[model samples]
Target: MAKELLKGNEAIAEAAIRSGLEAYFGYPITPQTELLEWLSRRMPELGRTFLQAESELAAINMVYGAACTGARVMTSSSSPGISLMMEGISYIAGTEIPVVLVDVMRGGPGLGNIAPAQGDYNQIVHGGGHGDFHPIVLAPASVQESIDLTVEAFDLADKYRAIVVVLIDGSIGQMMEPAELPPMQPIQKRNQEWAVTGAKDRERRILSSIYIDPEDEEVINFRLLERWNEIEANELRYKEYFMEDAELVVIGFGTAGRVALSAVRAARSEGIPVGLLRPITVSPFPYARIKEQTELACGMLVVEMNSGQMLQDVLAAVGGKIPVEFYGRMGGVVPLPDEILAEIRRLCYEPVAPSANPRISWMNRMNITKN
Candidate 1:
């Protein structure tokens, strides 16, 4: 197989087709619009299903309908569209239906403009759909990452009998890079021993997250939290770069993660002991892994496109063992590597007052409409 230059959105669309998704139900949303456009044509040509739903509500319901039939399904939307689909996602989570939701996140709150912002971090990772559950979320920072993780998202969704989200943003979805196509093989539909598609000749499976009784709901919550704990123990994944002998560590994900990577490389050239903790799975956040690394650093710096969403998680994970600082450029404006590298230098080598705040805020931030 040969590799080709593809935008992150295009890579995801191509990977989905190659993964043999039975259908895609989505409405056009910026950043991810090109992906829907690409798949709408190719899926029909390949004798598959692609429906441009009238609205986010309709599209998510379409996903609900399709997943009920034991189909591999997906949908793409930005922040607000994803907000509208929350009800459906909660229903799907409650029923334990298998699904994959792609959130090419843009600026959030209301109709935040079509620039990349990860403000949806807490919402997506912390049960945005209203339930005591954690969806398997794969956060990819590059075009190749988008392709690889899209296919893995479906697999994980099926494996867990739950929703899996590939969380990205405008730059990753729109930026171009080279990626190789994998051979197509039909993903085995999850065995229906537990799912509630229909009972052909046996006791019917019931997929419902609702329990009327408070005790039963409590039990369900306990079971769900236990399951999440299991996931955290076994599935929390992250990538570490240049951390063996580092004085400061930089943490980020998605597009911000990529930018931080560049800063890490630059600091390395200048002989600064800088490392990176780029998380691949944000839902089962790599708290333990981060804690392990922070033990060796002077301080940890969190860089994101939001007003320090992930930074909170870092603080909780740090347990005040070391000072944790945040540097961000929110709204549509993403921080450049050179800008981040400057912050890295300040944190790496600086004299400060005992009460001085180390946070860095770039001047070119955009106004974010919070929802």
Candidate 2:
């Protein structure tokens, strides 16, 4: 493996290339526009079909059509653009076609802004469209993870006959870092026993989630639930540091998770007893492992770029066995190590609990502004 300096978006594009993605379809959106442009320029050199979709909706729908033909296809967009693709994503989900969608998130609710944000966590993990299905959402914190997960998403999606999403943000997508490229592999379509390439050559294969009978609907749900259970059992991935015998544990994901690790080191140096839990698989959520860790820790502090999405998961995981607290900066505000360390100090030194009188003093505001 040879290391090369690469931006996160470039790494993802290269990974798709090396993974032998059959086609690329996407519209330009901030934080991820370079991703599509990279494919547009590079795919042709390798004689792969790359389409600059007129809109996000069209891009995702084109992915849907290509996926029906059993092609390894992908599309990318930011938050608002992803919202536009939700209906089509629903269609893709119902059709149960394998595709990869990359979300380079930006501040949202509207035109928002071109900046790093993880506010899309809930929407991506919980199924944005109207349906009872979940997309396998992968959150990558670094260039290397982005490359590895991008390639892995295809394999996972193909195996499950479902969609795999690489949920990243501007910071990771745009940030330059060192990555080692994996050797390219030929992407021949596998399992004609299930693919719909040509019926004349084999039995007809239907790629869809539409079930009419009530019993069959239940059967489909059961099959999907079983697959999800397997996902929970084996696909969950996370990282922990300095957690043994710690009094307080900091939980976060993506770039926020990286900064929280630094804060854990700083708090440890200050004798504030701290550790970190960085979640890599946001979908499987690593709830059981988080619950086990909460058994020993005094408290769990969830740090996130969003208001408190991951915090709720932490609370549910711990089930009040330990005190759960939250600290966040929303709408693209990425918290720093010092800011996270301050929260750790409060959790370590202060006796604030869910029952403790909430300290809503004006001093807190002054301190935050001053800091």
**Residue 360 lDDT in candidate 1:** 36
Model 1, 245: alpha-carbon shift in Å?
0.8
Taken over the whole model, the C-alpha lDDT of each candidate is: 0.84, 0.84
Count of residue pairs whose backbone atoms collide, per candidate = 3, 0
lDDT of 1 by residue, 264-344 (tens): 999999999999999999988988888887668878888999888888788778877777777887777898999789878
The Cα RMSD of model 2 versus the native structure comes to 2.3
Extract clashing residue pairs from model 1: 94-209, 109-370, 109-371
What lDDT does model 2 reach? 0.84
Question: TM-score for model 2?
Answer: 0.94
Query: Model 2, 332-367: lDDT tens per residue?
Result: 878899988888888888866664311232236436
TM-score of 1: 0.93
Residue 279 lDDT in candidate 1? 94
